[model samples]
Target chain A: MKKNDIIVIVLVAFLALGIGGYYFATRTESKNAKVVIEVNGQLYKEVNLYEDQKVEIETSNNHKNVLEIKDGYASMVEADCSDQICVHQRAIHYNGETIVCLPHLIMVTVQSDEEYSVDSVAN
Target chain B: MSSKKTATFGVLVALAFIFSYVESTIPFNFAVPGMKLGFANIIVLVTLYLLGSKEAFVISMIRIILVGFTFGNLNTMMYSLAGGLLSFAVMALAKRFDGFSIWGVSVLGAIFHNVGQVAVAMLVLQTSALIGYLPFLLVFGIISGVVIGIVGAELTKRLRVILKV
Candidate 1:
């Protein structure tokens, strides 16, 4: 590779690392985090992350996703969507962490109670 | 366009479509959603260098649509289109600038591809929190882009001599 090519690669790598580092440093573990689930950009459910439960979300389009919350973490255990990308994603427990199922238009986000309340107030 | 050029475009599109199919079957189990090896991009990059940016764009679009119908759904197709368009735009601009080598252009395309896909995800899901996933996707994009760039540059060199373009 030429000098310019190496420079571009390094710049991109550094930029990615910087953004990733910022997110990592800002991620705060919350004791009162809540798992907020949304379907089609609309709020579907909000449950305490500490409370272990399974949320079955079926969209109007017949797409289905099974979200399981346990041990202060939330994950998609099952999805009828062909890609199954959400099902294979890692669980989220820290505030601002998210699991998204694009086909089903489902998003599960972990937000602290304070942030959740602020979000609700804004909405 | 010359008939030979048209035939080459058709063959490139078919090759890109097959690459998409091959990539889908590989079962990339990276926990990050929407992450891909971007194998089909190799063909797109080669086309960009061999033919032209406009030809490359046409091939990329056709490949995405064809693969979408055969192995993906509308949602997937939308994501692919978003990624493909953005990726192609960036690569074409980089080529025009001529500041970087083929590897640099390929890396940029790969990185922007993920960015475009994530942008669509944020819009469709209506949650900016998905931005948190950008770093992981970016890192993966760089790795995959480098590999594809190596293969693409080699193929472009071989094809130029064979096609005498």
Candidate 2:
């Protein structure tokens, strides 16, 4: 194999592991932890762990999106507009979990005391 | 470009849209949202290698605009444009690298696309927190880019033999 091919192979392997690791590290099963919702850096509401309820998060853009918390696992159930990307997001159940709806500037995420920050790409 | 080349490019654009729609439908359970195989990029890759940078840019732009409009994703147009442009520029630069092939160019393009999209997200949301997802996106972008690039390169090889372009 060419040197460039080897480099690409190594790069691909490193990326796969990094991505896989990030996903596993950030993911938390909603077994015992409580459900918390935050918007625009404020604690909006917290879903009671004991109840199976659907939380409707109304964003500033007037778009209504729903998060269903059943038995502690929280996932987006429905969205008003097309391309329901948030609705398609994996269920997040941890502090500092975030699902951003760009059109609305609304971010629905779980919050943990731990800070989870990723790097920004140069322009 | 010759009439024949123009017609070929048109066909490539159509193929890109078809692949885009097809890939968009095959759902995968990934951790990140809005992540996909982006198989349609194969056409763009092939175009870049076979035709030239400028032609490939036109083709990529046309594909994004057409697909976005058809899907009514006006909000995502900016993100897609930024990502696509950055990717194309990266691929063009990759062409300058020693012994660079279409595959290398496409992979670089894909990585740049992910970076560009994430950058847009951070700026639009005015939050640096979203940067956390960049690594994963880059990793996936490279894998997907290479796969699409391989397909594009293989097709270009066959076309070079058949069409003698």
Candidate of highest DockQ: 1
lDDT of 1 by residue, B1-165 (tens): 899988898889889998998999998877887788999999999999999999999999999999989998887899999999999999999999999789989999999999999999888877788888788888888888899999999999999998889
Measured by lDDT, the strongest candidate is: 1
Please list the C-alpha lDDT of all candidates, in the order they appear.
0.90, 0.73
Per-residue CA lDDT of candidate 2, range A1-123, in tens?
Answer: 246755775776687688668766876644345566655555667765446889888866577878788865678788886666777777766554667766655566554432322222321
What lDDT is reached at residue A27 by model 2? 66
Colliding residue pairs in candidate 1: none
Q: List, residue by residue over A28-106, the lDDT tens digit for candidate 1.
A: 9888888888888889999999999998998988878899989998999999978888989999988889898888788
Share of reference contacts kept by candidate 1:
0.73
In model 2 chain B, the worst 10-residue window by lDDT is B27-36
Predicted model with the maximum TM-score: 1
Model 1 residue A57 lDDT score: 90
Model 1 ranges off by over 4 Å: A115-123
The TM-score, computed over Cα atoms with residue i paired to residue i, of candidate 1 is 0.95
